[model samples]
Target: MTEVAEICSELLRIDTTNDGGGDGPGERRAAEYVAGLLDEVGIEPHVFESAPGRTSVVARVPGDDPDGLLVHGHLDVVPADPAEWRVHPFSGEIADGCVHGRGAVDMKGTLSMTLAWARENARRGARPRRDLVLAFLADEEATGAYGAGHAIERHRDLFEGCSEAISESGGFTWHEGDVRIYPVAVGERGTAWMRLTARGVAGHGSKPAVDNPVAELARAVARLADHRWPVRLTPEVARLIDELSRALGAPIDVDRLEEEIRRVPRAAALFRGVLRNSANPTMLNAGYKVNVIPGSAEAHVDGRFLPGQRDEFLETVDRLLGPKVTREFVSFEEAVSSPAEGLFDDLTAALLAEDPGGRPVPYVMTGGTDAKWFARIGIRGYGFAPLFLPPGLDYFGMFHGVDERVPVEGLEFGVRVLDRLLSSESSTM
Candidate 1:
């Protein structure tokens, strides 16, 4: 097995499961393991704890250029059930030429590639073209309050000269016939985690109440779920579509985008959730007893908006929900968009250098990441955790899915691509 695969397996074995509540085993152990790995390469790493066991690690590799490049990956994984998987979720078993585990694809495998790249550079006594800031963050699966948020709030000086960052959710191989397409993320949709409440009269089971909060809330939830958001294309997605048109030699109608996406099966997964805003009711709460009518009802929604469309999204949502239900934000963050012209050129060059036929395109991520936190400090973040996968692997479906895994060969391929990216000189910095 390659060292990168081994490292990923070991990381998967350490259960850094963040249940979003303060329940799961924290990331302290994983932070320490990463710190030890950096120490082996004669690099000093600083480990910080936001709370008792919520931990993060940061280390810098000084380089010839003054410009800094931040490479970050989270240590947390969403909770997984062992009984639901082909192999135990936390077993980190190497089976069928893949590393099988909960975090093998969500993030741990990508982190392993970065760790391997740093260690390999140390072995050769080489430094990157620009200053490299490596951060292993915590609480990413949750609010990121204890991870990137904490680091920026308390220790912003640690990332002094850094302007650009590369993290998860992009730069993986997507095969279409003989074509290898790499979608590097240039932006992400904004988050609007909301809580809705409906107020009415509390009554006995037999009483015929005029105002039932439970019914009101259920109707609002249904309306929100049934509303079909229209396509609001941002620059990042437009660029992706344009490139896909040229690469696949398929004509795409901007007016009939949904139909066009359906025609190109390979681009459907990448374009599905990102073309417009979306909201789904995830949780609901009402009366304690089935027979009792509740005074108030509450529901939670996972809402996402395309870049530059937050206000419009909220207005439409309010219209759909009606005034019977009131809404308040549980968590709200702006969409992050990076320039597609400069540093992206460097990323594309690096990918093509390793795989000449690989076509690199820019896309907006449907979900948020720790990148949102970094964007607060004026840092541009790109989702680029390079991986080369075989055609049959359902790469996108593996995130927080059953039987999550990463191919062994993909990890090694990522390490080489990372090395090339770090070696290349770019004017963006």
Candidate 2:
């Protein structure tokens, strides 16, 4: 096995599942494993836990420039049910030229690549142009309250002088017909986790009550779930569409953009969610007994809004909820966007160097990342892990999905691209 794959497999076997709100087997073990690797490379690492067992590790490699790069990856994986997988989720088994495990794709694989790159450079007595802050974080699967969020809040010094950061969900190969497209994430939709509550007079189930909270809540949820959010294309997504059109040599019709987007093979699936605001009812609670009507009903919605659309999204949600139901934010993080023209050229050059004819495009992630937290401290985050996978592999599908796995060759590819990116003098065209 390649060094990158071995590191990923070893980390995967540790079982660092983060089940939100400070639950599950914390990432202490995985954090220790990563710190050990960094320590062996003669780099001193600082490890700490925001909560018991919720550990994060941070280390830095000095470069010629003071303001350097920050490359981070979460050590925690989403809880994987062993019963739902063909193999044990945490087994970290290698077969069929793939590393089969929980975090093979969602991020541990990238973490492994980052560690391997740093170790290799250390062994060869080589360093990059700017300082490199390597952070192996915890609690990413659970909203990063105890991981990136914690580190940024409690230990900001670790990331000092780092203006740009790179993390997960990008730099992977996407195949569309005869083309190989690499998407590097430049923006992410905001998180608007909300809770709705409706209160009314409690009454017997048989009685014909005019205002039943459960019925009201059900109606509100139905409206919110069924509401078709209008297409509000952000700049990042617009650039992606335009770039894809140029690369594919296809004329794009702005009025018929949605239809045109769907025509592109892999582009459609990635761009669909970012085209509009979305909210889906995830959890519902109402009556305790079938015969009795509860006075209050509650529901949880997973809502996401495109960048610069929070006000409009909230107003729309309020309108859908009506006067009978009241909604409040469970957790809210604003959408993040960085100028697509910056640092993207370097990423594209690195991918082309590894696999010529590969087209790298800017992507707007439908979901949020710990990048939101880092943005609090004037740091711009880019999703640039750099993985080249086979055309047949559904790279995005493996994220927190059943049978999550990464190709052995893909891990090696990431190591090379990331090493080049880190070693480069400038990440600009």
Candidate 3:
């Protein structure tokens, strides 16, 4: 089998689901399998178990320069609903020329690419200006507490002598008239997962009561969804937009732009979603029966904030919901700082070399990842899962959607681009 095929098969065979996290993040089988390959290639791999079953493996590619580079990816994937997938989530089935499985595009495909590149480099006795670190982590779906987060907190020495790193993120295709500029992800939004408690007096459902928490909670949820935050343009984001506009050979007028953004269907649909502070009430709890008016209601929200905008975002949400709603943060991760365009140009070259007709663009990730945690320790990461998604497919919607599968050629394209970038002088890593 080819490198992409082999790694894809290996990843599919291991069910590193996050549901097994309590007993350890369930990456033991996957990590061990990856270790075997490293051993075969003469690279001593270090495997650590955060919990009973959650295992993390780290391997380094010896380089010419003393400066070290770390390429990290999560082994654990979010639980896949078996009933929803066309192929068995763990079957590693290659149908219609594409590998079908959980974590295929999320990061596993990228991991496979990195592994194959490392092995080939080692075999050729090829070394770069810096050492290369490959970390296959566990427990990213929930938090990095057991994975990359743990590595940074517990094994700080593991990343010693490293100046730069690249991970799965920030690089993807976007159509803007005629230009296809690949955007190397420079930053991400901060993550805030919060729980809110709404309290009121309980009463009989038959008797109309005013102090019902459920009613109050419904109002709060509506406002959270409908409310919009003011747009704050940061340098990187503005540059990304400007580059895209320039590449398309279109003029951007800052004053009427907001109106244009709100009116233009395609541009509005894509850019507006992740532009500002966002609040989503994903889980809710209230009365158990159909007749009772619950005294208290509980709900959890997945909120994201731009860099340095957390304080304002929380304040706004609090005010909009009124004093009845009290919130507590379950987890808080800050937005990461992004690198400049020079690195991105190298990525564009990588993409062009692989497929000359493909278009790449910069994006502002509306979600959070291990990249949030790595920023503090001086590591720059991006959300770069490269693919040639069809126009009508809605790439963003596929993440938690049913039948999530990547094209076979898209995977190959990404592997080739990534490998080319890794070996080039232009790549910061």
- The number of clashing residue pairs in each candidate reads 0, 0, 9
- Model 2 worst lDDT window (10 residues): 420-429
Root-mean-square deviation per candidate? 2.4, 2.1, 3.3
In model 1, what are the clashing residue pairs, if there are any?
Answer: none
Candidate 3 residue lDDT tens string, 1-429: 577677876787688778633654448888998888778878889888766777889887767666776778888777888887788888888887677788776767777877776666666656654677888888877788888877888877778876667776656555544444455566778888899889998888899878989888889988998896777776666766676566556655555657757554454444455567788989999998888898999899999888778888989889877889888998888877666665566666677777687656666676767776677788766666566544544555556555556666666666666667766342311
User: Which stretches of candidate 1 lie above 4 Å from their native place?
Assistant: 24-26, 424-429
The model with the greater lDDT, 2 or 3, is 2
Score each candidate by Cα lDDT: 0.90, 0.87, 0.72
Off by over 4 Å in 2: 24-26, 424-429
Worst 10 residues of 3 by lDDT: 420-429
Top candidate on lDDT is: 1
Tens digits of per-residue lDDT, candidate 1, 5-36, equal 99999999999999989643749999999999
Off by over 4 Å in 3: 20-26, 176-181, 202-211, 252-270, 288-295, 352-360, 385-394, 424-429
lDDT for 278 in candidate 1 is 96
- Model 1 TM-score, 2 decimals: 0.97
